[model samples]
Target: MSFAKEVKNELTQMQTEDCCTLACSYGLLLFSRAFSVSEISLLTEHSGVASLYCDAVALLSGYVADLQETPGGYSQVSVRDRQQRINIFEKLGLPVQSPRKQINLANLQNECCFGAFLRGAFLACGTVTDPTKDYHLEFSIPSAGLCEQFIKLFDEFDLSPRTTRRNGVSVVYFKNSTDIEDILAHMGASDTYMEFIGAKVIKDIRNQVNRKCNFENANAKRAVASAGAQRDAILYIQEKRGLDSLPKQLRELAQVRLDNPELSTAALLPLLSESLTKSGLHHRMKKIEQFAEELKNRSENEN
Candidate 1:
């Protein structure tokens, strides 16, 4: 199943008290596809969410909503009876004819009820992308007023959310991984939240390992190139004036390069006749290259 479905399934299994049940049901109905005095419907791809919606309706209004599967393979639950929709609104203490659907903060009895309400809203209209792909969680609400209320509710929990409109639906979304994880945790999906955290840790470690490997590979390439250039300078000096023409220390370093052309400057340091730091060895190599360049220039001028 998808990660979002997994989260909803986990939420559906949570145990709720009388107050939390009412609060959660309010969220589910308010954010559903349609929730008014005339009609109350919830359309979802998750069967667990559909079942939860039906259970919430039965518990809150003493009415059983019609649940059916559409041709497109979606579970749709609807209460078409006008009396039943009014009954639901009465049980939830919602206005029968509000200008637009909005959250009833009076239903959220306590802090725990807030969490439960958010859980139900998620089950109704929320989705989360797989942590392996990206960190994104959103709720698609049909009413702009309801969407704005959700944004304020998120702020109450110290979670920052952004808003946008897509296809006439108001969407409240969070892209930060921490925010998504917190939302799952608050929704009582502790197991799914732990799984998401594990995925994030693994991804972070993999990225760090890749960056370290790239750094080492680049360093190795630079070492090889530097060694190749030093070897070319030594070869030129040998072919022109010969090793005997160089001073004692320079001649010894030149011979070492001719013997171990593939070794880096640091690796060649130990093979030197006299003790020298890496910096001193580098200085000597630069001097040898300079000498060869001067000799080449003089030869060219003479010709």
Candidate 2:
């Protein structure tokens, strides 16, 4: 099941305030596919949302809507009775004549009601991505004006959502995992919210481990390249002036590096007969490299 469906299922099991539930039902019907005085209709693929809508309407208007299941996995719920539709509008505080299809927050009694309203809106047209893959929650609004209004509602709760238009529909979305979690929790899907948090923790740990591994690999590559260059310099000096011509300490360090070309300066420390700190060994290797470079430059100038 989709994360969105999971959330709706959880919502279906929760107990909500009667007035708030009615307001939520109002939101779903008003913003859904069709809402008019003569006919109130909603189409959904989620059987849970369809049932919730039918029940919420029945609770509010005292009339059960007709649920028609089509061949394409859609459940269409409609109240074709004109009086029932008018009563639903009156119960929802919607004008009986040409009411604007916008969310009226005043109908909601409290924070719980507001949350329920958002839940109903989500049931109508919201979707959330699997937290294991990505953080995304969006609502497809039918118009830009309604989209902005919805954004204000989110802002009231500090959801920090963004909006865009796609194919003539306005989309309100949030990418932040924290925002998504807070939204789910606000809508009373605590279990799904906890699951999202767990997924986020796992993803964060994996990312941290990968970063550490990449950093260590980079350091290893740099060390290998440096060790290779040092060995090459030692070979150049030995070929040109011979190791015996160098200072005794430099000669011994050069021989040790030549024998163990793969070892780092720190590793070569224990191999030396005269003990030296890692930095002391590095200093000695630097002098040998400088001498080799001078020899090569002079040979080039002479040629």
Candidate 3:
């Protein structure tokens, strides 16, 4: 039949993760844009493709989880799929650390349901030219907590989905460029992305350091300037003997204004909580300005 039908057929037959013929098909499609042995090498910086599925899955799942909702309750197919995926750990004879909970990845990476999952995502992508237009995330969250199990399956990198309901036929979007990029990034394929390409991790780190340093240095300078300006104004007030003394509320507002010289009255409104009304925030700033003028007059008188 069509490519989409072939994907569905493949997904039906596969149960666990390893590497699949379909994933190769999927990779070929992705690589059609640009592919290289070097890209794969860079992606597997820490380990081989076969072992990094969990980390890859977690990243991919988190991306999808952030997008859409799923069915609310459990389904036989979903349950069956999860159990089968979990069975990979068992099949590899990996130790189940606890009596009830078993199938730890470290013990049995080979047993992971990864191959099937990668294929599913790949197959889904293969059938779509436009995922957003073609499908939406439609997994249901159930009271029986199928969502939890669904997340677990999703975490295995064996599945990627989007929920869609059209003509009352609920369909999950499988793969798209966005999803594939997410998957590749999850697999440590940082070099393939714009920000993460050759200049990504180092550039990001450098930019972060620059941001922190700039903020701290600028804030420190502002704090010193504000403190000096406030002190000078206070001294001028004392010297001028204006209105006996400034009130505590007025003084605090004055200090705040100097401390945040760039702050607009509207932004200052949040700090006022119960302190002022819409107009009152502006009024308070005006009061500070008038007091500063009065201080200037007193300094002039003393001089």
Candidate 4:
């Protein structure tokens, strides 16, 4: 099953006896889906979600929803009777005719109610990506007013979410792993929350290892290239100016470099009879290159 479905199933297993909390959850589910005074309908692929919605409405308003199982593993639970629909709206304190569709925060009298409301809304039209692939949890709201209300609700719970549009639906989404994990935990999906945490830790460790390896590989490449350039300079100086023409210190450093051509400047340091720091070895190598450049200039002048 998808992670979203797994969370919804977990939510269904939670038992709530408070009428206000159940009504609030019913309100969120009905208003968030295709609901009206004359007709209310919810279509879902998960039987657990459909059953949860039916039970919530039944418990709150004593109205039974028509449950139908269709092909392709879909369950459709709907209230088509006008009185039943009105009963649901009235029990939840929602007016049948409103200028704008918005969540009535008055129904959410406590934290439990608030959580139940969000859980119902998720069962209605929320989805979360598998944490292994991406970090995303979103609610597909139908109206702009409802979207704004959902954002405020997130803020009230100290959750941050971003908004976007897709196919005329307003999406309130969380991309950060922490935000997603917090949401799942708030909704009482402790197991899925821990699974997300595990996935995040593994991903972070893998990325860190890859970055360290890349850094070391880059340093090794640079060291080898520098050694090659220094070798060429020393060879040119020896062939053109002769080793004896160089100053004593330069001659000794150049011979050390020639003897250990495979070694980087730092590695060549300990091999030298006279101790010098890595920087000191680099300075001597630069002087050798300078002598070689002078010889090249003299040869050009003669030509």
Using lDDT as the measure, the top candidate is 1
Model 4 Cα lDDT, one tens digit per residue, 258-282: 8997887899888878989889888
lDDT of each: 0.88, 0.84, 0.39, 0.79
Model 1 per-residue lDDT tens digits across residues 156-186: 7899898889999989999999999889888
Query: Pairing residues by index, what is the TM-score of model 4?
Result: 0.87
Give me the candidate number with maximum TM-score.
1
Q: Model 2 over residues 1-303: C-alpha lDDT tens digits? A: 887778888977778777777767767876677677766788999888899889867976898999999999899999878898888878777788654446676788776887887888888888899999999999988556567677888866877788888898888988998899888988888889888899999999999999999999999998899899999998898898899989999999999999998887789988989989878988998999899999999999999
Residue 92 of model 2: what lDDT? 70
Runs in model 1 with CA error above 4 Å? 295-303
Model 3 alpha-carbon drift over 4 Å, by segment: 1-19, 22-120, 123-182, 185-200, 203-207, 234-303
Candidate 3: 10-residue stretch with minimal lDDT: 37-46
Q: Model 1 residue 277 lDDT?
A: 92
| Backbone N/Cα/C clashes per model | 0, 0, 23, 0
User: Between the candidate structures 2 and 3, which one is better when assessed by TM-score?
Assistant: 2
TM-score winner between candidates 3 and 4:
4
Candidate 2: lDDT over CA atoms? 0.84
* TM-score of each model, in listed order: 0.93, 0.90, 0.27, 0.87
